[model samples]
Target chain A: MIPHDEGNGTSKPHAPRIGVVFGHPSRQYAPGEELVVRYDVEGVELPAIRAMERTVVWYTEGKGEEDLGVHRFERIDDLAGLAEALPHGTITACLPASPLSYEGVIVKIRWCVRIRLFFVAGRDFVSEHVFEIGAIAPARGVVERVQ
Target chain B: MRLPPFFGKKRGHRRTGSQAWGSFGEAVFYAALVAAGLCFAGLLLTGAVGIGPESAAPGWMRGWLWIFIWLIPGALLAFGVAGVARTVRDWGKSEERRAAAEGLGTLLESMGQSPAAQHPFPGVPACDDLVNSPGTILRYRLPIESPESWTLVGMGLFAGLWNAVLVVLAVSAGIDIASGRIEWVLLAVLVPFVLIGVTGIVIFIRRLVLTTAVGTTQLEICDHPLLPESSYDVLLAQSGSGMLRSLVLTLEIEEMASFRQGTDTRTERVIVWRDIVKEWTNLEITPGVRFETHVTVAIPAGAMHSFGSGHNAVRWRLVVRGQPERWPGFVRVFPVVVHPAPPAESAAVRHGATADGVPG
Candidate 1:
């Protein structure tokens, strides 16, 4: 199904029937803004999971080796209960000011909320939802931040 | 087809007489310094007091040699004293003279020989057609054929022929090794050729495939002036002749950052967001004809506007890839500028245009 047009409305579906979404409806966020990440799980019968971790990472993609800066990581509720019933949870992370999301001819910087669900099988289910993080809008002049 | 003047002209260089004269004078001055040092060394040795043996030495000849050596020292002293006096006099000059001297030094420091600025070399300017051409509002068409396109064609032919030769040689070597007719040392020699053959074959196939579908890609943004959050019609026009087995068009915004390492500057391209705007199979176009299509893409709000400077840049491009059966795929990237979203009031007016005023 075609996702909604809102930047924040974009969602990614993962293995084990998991869906991830961002709480804020827009993908574009100002620096220092709180990133609210929402996750939902379907079905309860599954292998015993070890842990669920959600990380906010800013990364580069394209033309060169990928580089990532982990901004936040928080363990979520136990995965066992989510399998018994439909599970829903949200994680809030405060964003930092740097490495503002950028796009260029040879390089692109992206900010995404990555969710990883670890299973005892040593395999992890990972999914990410990308969003834009920019500086606060200026009144008239352009904001020039050098990194 | 005639290419734009910007791309047609080749850079020309001419060595000027002044440059040659300057170099000659510098060489002469340095030679003179060397000669002076050599003369001083000879004077030092000739002026030495010892003769092989006092009895075997001619006293008159020694005396004459001493006189000549003494004259050499006198000349050196006179030159040194003159140079010191001239330097002291120059140092006592007025402020104006000092300023003039400083300005001359700066000018010489700043002077450098580089490619003449008058010629507009292709590459950046060629890719910046959208900005250079003012009338390119909705549709920006590439002017004539680019040297890059020709290069692809040439490289394809060269690689293809070379690969064929390598393949023949490799097969012969392989048969020899398989039949145990060649020495083990021959295997070692054949390994490198086989590796090169395989690499050449891949490059040859890739280049040929690209050449088969080589064409210019043009981009047309639906909105006269693109605005954020609003869906705008994105148009792609591919000009070429052939049947494409699988073709895909991708729209992406990427941010690029450049840093310097030693003397080389490297750039990194990170895709902010990308989507396959269109995909097709068995698409056919008239030979030597233009084919155009329109798709819709929303410029996500909060995305940075196009940026460029010395060290960093952000760019938006419509990338099209075409794959033909048994042929290598080719990609064409068209640069587009996403101007800052118009003011809210202006956007409203643009959207408020009468239905009749809108083009079909």
Candidate 2:
């Protein structure tokens, strides 16, 4: 998902609100495991949504420019599809083996499921839910040692 | 109760218009500079400005002054053109990105289809180039991180340019001396240029000799994109004339992080883990023949996979440190990637085991 500061516009009061919940309560997953997500939209009518995008992506966060990869993506624009996905929906995808979640001193990798609601006004609202992808230990601070 | 739009506090979530305004302002500033440069050049060309040989200055002085005076408008024109070109390029890129975003939205909405799959390893570097070059014994040859030939060429170029400048100054001084007029200032300038030129030449020659004597180190691996908990054979080839000291090969994991501090960006790298793969002491390499050795590299089961992003990386490399007799030591690095281990079930299947943990 694009960061708010980098995106083009802001969410308005009447904008649709998205709520996402993962299948696992712990929100931690192993590599090559299936990830299931359920989402619900509220505070706006289905007609206001020009399109809806669901994506499972991992992004880098820290001192560097953000890099991201989409593992799964789906778009629903038809009225019938929107009707089914508006109030409630579910998405499932088998995660890839690489780029496990990492928490480092200066670099961190995070996985999230974003449900973006694109309104007719050319603005998008992205709701992200963070999850873990691996059990790798977090990297510690720099330690000076002579070679 | 909902607050009115006018009185509502603007949350940081909204994208700011400052970037657009900044780009527009930059374009305008560069456009103005271009206009000013053109106007100045036109005035000079039309003889509106009184900078010409018509003045009482000497002929040679006037010629030099004319060139010096034109440099102002030349620099302005160059900077203006470059800035304008950069602005146009940036504008085109932004437009392309905007169009792509809009097009993807429209296309997906109309077709109701998913986009293409992303790269398997998002942040990892591609190993296509590394695997493309076939090795003699091993399957793949790992390219060096930084080749010594490039450094030799750079040093040679610097020495050549510096000596060229020194020769020009010496020729001018020689002409003055032959004409029975010793230009003290020219001679004074030539002295420093001569010293610097000689120093540069000496440095370049020393580096060339060292590079030749230390020779080249090549590493070849049995496979590409290694996996954890696996062992692979590696070939180390060392070629040089005289190497009497020691040669060490080590497998190291390094973490690099870059952060911008004010105007400058500083990068820091640390070797988080290292293990000595092999070491050879008191080895002599004959001329025109390479010393070859085979070693096994075993990756730790819990090793972190190679990772790379915009400004941060976790890299694995095989470093060859050679200490030569009568020459400074040199280090050559061969980068390698370690991928995450396959899933347990898949690994079991590869080992010819069924899902019930029985041999199939």
The DockQ assigned to candidate 2 is 0.28
| Candidate 2 residue pairs in clash (backbone atoms < 3 Å) | none
Docking class of 2: acceptable
Q: After superposition, how far is residue A9 of candidate 2 from its true place, in Å?
A: 11
Off by over 4 Å in 1: A1-147, B1-128, B131-139, B142-209, B214-216, B222-225, B239-242, B288-290, B342-360
- Candidate 2, residues B1-360: lDDT per residue as tens digits? 222232333343333443345566788888888888888889889999846656988888887887887887888888888998877767623222333354466456646534443335545666666787889998888998765668889989999999998888888889889999999988888888888899999989998888877778899988878766666789999998775599999987777777777899877777766778899999999998999999877776656788886677888889998888878888888999877766672323222111221110
Instruction: Assess every candidate by TM-score.
Output: 0.36, 0.70
List fnat per candidate, in order.
Answer: 0.08, 0.24
* A1-147: candidate 1 lDDT, tens digit per residue: 111111112223434555767666777876667888677755423455665666677666544445555666555445554443235677688776555676543555678776555556443444567887764222222122212
